[model samples]
Target chain A: MSTADRRRLLGPIDASPLYSDITPKVHSSVGEAGKSDKEVRKVFIKTGLVSNASGSSYIEASNIIVEVSVFGPRPIRGSFTDRASFSVECKFLPYLKQPQEDLFRGDTHANNNGRQGLTEVEHKISQYVETAFLPCIILEKYPKSTIDVFITVISTGNTTAPSSILNLTNWIVNCSSLALIDSGIEIKDIVTSGHIKYLQSEQRLIVDPLENEEREDALDCLVSFESLKNDEIVGLWIDGNQKLLTEELLSKFIKECSSMSEKIRANFNNYLLKLCEN
Target chain B: MQEVDQISFPPEVLSRIAPDLSLERHLKLGLRPCLRSFSEFKPIAVSSPALEDEPNLVGSSIVSHGQTKVICGISIGVVEAKNQSDTLNQNETNSQDSKSDGEYDAEPVYPVVDIARGRTGAPTEEEMILSQRLYEWVLQSKIIPASALLTNPGVAIANQTSSSQGSSADVTILYPEDSDMPDLFSRVKPYKFVLYVHLKVFGRSGPLFDPCHAALIGALKNTRLPRIYVPDSSIYSIKIPIRSRGNFGHRVKETRIFIDENQDLSNPLQLNKDNIGGASNYGLYDLSPGSTSMDVDPNVIILADLEGDAEEAECMSKLNLIYNPNKKSINNISYSGGGMVLTKDTLKQCFKLAKKRAENTQ
Candidate 1:
C-alpha cells in the first residue's frame, strides 16, 4: 500500500487493529519495513514504544512501561548439555504502598518474599515473558549456566499507555544486556514485543493504549516478536480476551508481527555489529 | 591546674575567645569582647567548682556557637518506688539478659516513662533520643551507686501501703548460697533520682547563642551540685558540642567539643554527632571535691546538635524569638527571651530578683 493508503487505513491515532489509540509520540519511534522512519512516511502501525534492550526491544501498548534486559551467550561452566538456562527477578520500590487489601493477602504471598516487590503487575508481565520469550531464544548453545534477566516497570502511568508489556519487555532486555556485559556474554539476536487493546467505546482501533483507556476500554491484545530462522514461536505474547475477532483483524495482528520482527532483527544485528566493532 | 579528672575546653580554646576564660572564669571573670571584636563573640573566664554541691555530680559548660540567651538545664529528682525502686541493685543489666532489643528489664521494670504534665506540643525526636540516651547511659554505667537504690523494708512511696507483695527490691534467692544468705539487704547510702532537663530557647532577646554551648553552660552552672571523683584516678571524659553552623545552613551536626582541665583548648576533638569519630576522644581534670568526689560522678549532659537558619530566620521567628538566630553570626550575644538576657540594666535587675528569691528560700 502507498503511504496515503496506509495512513487512511490506520485512520487518526484512534484507528488500529486494536482498541487503544497509537499515540503520535509513541508510533513514530518504530521503523517501517524496507523504509526508515522518515522514508516510510511514519506509518501509524509501527511499534514505536518498543524500548531498545541489550538485544531485545519491548513495545508497550497498554498501561505499563516495560524494559527488558537480555544477558548471556557467555561460556557455560558446569553442565555440558546443549541447552542453556535463564532466570528473571523483578523488583519494585518498597514505599509504594498499594491500596487494595485483597490484592496483598493469601495467593499474593506465594510470589512475595515479604518485601522483594515483584508487584502484581510485574507478575502479569513476567507470566507473559516466561510463556513467550523463553521459548524462542536459543539456549542449547550455552548449556550449563544461567542467564539472569531483570524486567522492571517503573510506572504504569495511570493505566492508559500499553506501558506494562512494553516497558517490561524493555527492562528485561536492557538488564539482560547489562548482566551479559558483566558476565562477558555475546548473542546472535535480540527480542521485542508489541501490544494492542480493543476499545469498545470509540469503535476505533488504537495501537498503544494510554493508562486511562486501559481502565475504560473493554479488551486488549499483546504480541511479542523475535526474528525466526525457522517457523517456530520465539519471544512473543498474544494476550487478548477479544472474543469476536474478524479473520482480517487476526491476520493484521499476526502480519504486523513479521514487520516488527524484521525491525527487531535488524536492530539487533546492527547493535551486535556496533558492539563487536567496539 | 588540677590533675586530669574530666574533659573540658582547652585554654587555647578559651583563647579562641581571646579573653581566655575558664568555667569559673567565664562566670567570675565577667564578659570581655572577643578578639573577633564581635561583642557577641566575647569570652569570659571559667573555673569549675571547689565546693561540694549536688553530691557525685559531673557537669560542664561550653560556650555555644551562639551566644544567645538559650539555656539548657538538667535537674535530678529522687522518688521512692512503690514497687520497684530506681536502679540501685548490683544486678548488671546486659544485652545477654535482654529478651529482645526493645524490652526493658523485667524485675526492676524501670519504665522509661515520660511525663507530659503541663506541656503543649508533642515531644520532639531529639528530646526523645536524648532521654533514651540517658536511659542507656544509666543502664551501661556504674556511676550511680547501686546502694542508693536500696528500699526501706515495708515502706513504699504510695498513698496507701499493701501488706503483702509490697514495693521492695524483689530479690530472688537462688540456692541461698548454701541456705545461709540473708533474705533482705539495705543500702549503706541512699539516693533516688529522675533527671529533668529543660532547654529553654528564650525568644532571641540576647546575642546569638548556640544551644549546644548554652547546654554546656547549663551543665557548667549545674556543677553547683555535688560531684564525686576518687583520688588518683585518671579522668577520661568527653565534652560534646552540637555543630549548628555549616554550608548547608541548618544541618544539625554535633562534634565533641572535648575539653581537659590541664590541656589548652587550642586543639580538641571535632566529633561527628552520635559518636561516629570513635575511641579517640578527650579527657579532663577531676573536679569532684574531697571524699565526696570518691563516690559522686558528675551528672551527664548531652547537647542537641546545632540547627540552621530554618530554626533561626524561620522556625524561631514563628516562636516570636525577638532576636533572629539568622543573619547574626552565633557568638556570645546575650538574648532576652525567657527574660534573663535583657539589656545589662534589666539583666542586673533580674539577677537581683533571683538572688532575693534564693534568700527567701534559705
Candidate 2:
C-alpha cells in the first residue's frame, strides 16, 4: 500500500502509551528500522519574506512550515543600557488539537472544539529558546536589555508535533538570522534546533512529529541544539508527565537531535551563501 | 587611479591567519607564517550576542557577506587594576615574557590585545601564530588588573549592598569604614580592561601579508570577551614561521605602537609625535607600549602582507619600534613574498590618505 493508505489504515496514529496498537507509530521509530523503503525527510530554507523584520526566513518540512523574523539589536526599547535584550513569543491556533478541522476555521484555526490551552505549547517554545539559544549569545555587552522574537503558527496541519515545532523554530531562527543580516542586524552565534519524540510502550522514536501521531503520543519532548562545535543542546521541551518519560527515550531523542541538527546546519550555511550573492 | 584590480596571495601564504581559514588552502601558501589584510578574508557576517528575554541573535540564518570576509570587532574595555580577579579564562593569554605577579607583588599587566578572528577557510598555521602572539600579549601582560574578573570568592558571594535599582540582576559594591583597602580581594578600583581583540578576514587566500596595515589605516584613514586582564610588557619572544631563502630563525628588528599628537595617553611613541595617520602601502605596528617610551619596538619579527596597485606580498624589515630615537631613514628592499615591516613612514602616509578620503567622502 502507498504511504497515505498505510497511515489511514493505522487508524489516525495515537501515542502508544494511551492507545497500544504500538505498530504504526513503530514505523517512524524504526525509521531506518530495517524497512527497505523508508525515507528520511529534510528541512529547507526560504528567504526574502517577512519585510517588517531585519532578518527573516522560513523552514518547511513534511506537515510543518515555520517562518521566523529577526529584528533589532537596535537600541532596545526598555531600560537596556550597556547590553542587548531578546524577547520570544510563540502562538499556536487556539484550537491546536484536532488538526484537520483546526485548519478550517478562521485565522485562529479553531480545533479541539475551541479548546487546548495554546499557552502551554507557546511556553515550551519560549523556555526552550531562552535556555538553549541565549548562552550562545554574548550577553555581557548587551547588558540590561531584551531582544524580542515573536513566532506565530499561521497554519496548523494534521499533527504538528512538539519535535516539529522545535525543528521548525531552529530552522526558522537560523533562516531569520540570515534575514536579520540582510537587514543589517548584528548576531552573536549561529544556533539551530531539533526535536525527537519517544513512545513509552514500544520504545519508538519519532524524528519530527505531525499532528496525528503527536495527539496520540503518551510522552513528548523537544530539544534545540544551539552550538556547532560543542553540539550543545540549548533548549529542551518535555511534554506529558516527566515521570512517564524513560531513560532509553531520552538517550534516543538526544542522539537523533544531534545528528539531525548537523544536517540542518549544513543547509542553513548554504542558504546564507546564497544570501551573500546579492 | 584605474581602481587597481584585486591582489591575490598564495594559499600557502594565507594560512598564517589562525583558525580563520581551513587547511587545504593553507597548503597553497605552504603554511608559511605571515599576516594578511583584513579585507583579504572571505566574507564574514557575525551577529552580536543574544540577550536573554530577547529574541535569539544566535540563529543558523547567517547574514552572508559575499566573498570570504573575516570580521574582528576590536572592543576596548578598561577598568582599574585592583578590582579584577587573579585567574584568567582558557582563552586569556599574553606573550611568554609577561612579568609574573610572583616577581613583582603589584605590577599591572599592560592592556593586552586578544583577537577572535573568523573566516571561511579552516584555520591556517599563520592564523594560529598571530592568534598565539596576540594571545600571549594579553595573557602574560603587566597592564590588566587580575582583581576585576573575580565575581565570587570560591563560593558565590552576594553583594553587601542591596540593589536599590530594584532590578533582579543589579549588583552593588560596598566597603565598610574598617575595611582594609590593601586587601587584594577588594573589588572597587576601575580597572582598565581590553576584553578581546576581535579580528575578521575577508576575500580568498593569498601569501603572507599585512591585515591591520589597511583596515587600521582605512578605519583611521577612511573614517573610523571577557576573561583575564594582562599587560604588554612581559612578552619575551613571538613564534612565527620563517619565510626566507634559507629556512632558519632570522633576525628582524622590532616595531612600535603608533601614537598620534592628539592622544591623551600617559606616554606615546616619541618619534614624530606630530605625524598622525599616513602610510598605507606598508604594514607598520607599535610592538612595545609604556609610559617611558612610545610605540615599543618588539624585536620579535615576522612577515606581513602589503597590497598596492594590485600586487600583494609579504615583507621583513629592520626597524626600531619603541619610540624611535633615530627617525633618519628607512631601508627599502625586496624579497620572496617579503618586504619591509610597517614603518612609521608607511603609517603616516596611510593616515594622510585616509584623512583626505574621509574629507572628500564627507
Q: Compare the candidates by DockQ and give the number of the best one.
A: 2
What is every candidate's alpha-carbon RMSD to the true fold? 30.5, 25.6
> Mind giving the per-residue lDDT tens digits that candidate 2 earns over A118-159?
355566666655565566656565566455564544333334
TM-score: model 1 vs. ground truth: 0.31
DockQ of each: 0.00, 0.02
Tens digits of per-residue lDDT for model 1 on B1-362? 86988756676565444332343243233322222210121222223322111111223332223333223333322333433433333244432333233333321101111211112234445344434443343343222333332222211122123444433232121121233333322321222223333333322212222233234333533333221111110111223343454634444322111111111211111111121100000001122223233232342110011122211221121110111122221111222123111234433333333233222221
Off by over 4 Å in 2: A1-40, A76-80, A93-118, A140-146, A160-185, A214-219, A240-244, B1-362
Candidate 2 per-residue lDDT, tens place, B105-127, comes to 22221111112221112345655
TM-score of each: 0.31, 0.33
DockQ-based class of model 2? incorrect
- How accurately is candidate 2 docked according to DockQ? 0.02
The local lDDT score (0 to 100) that residue B112 gets in candidate 2 is: 16
Judge candidate 2 at residue B299 and give its lDDT. Answer: 32
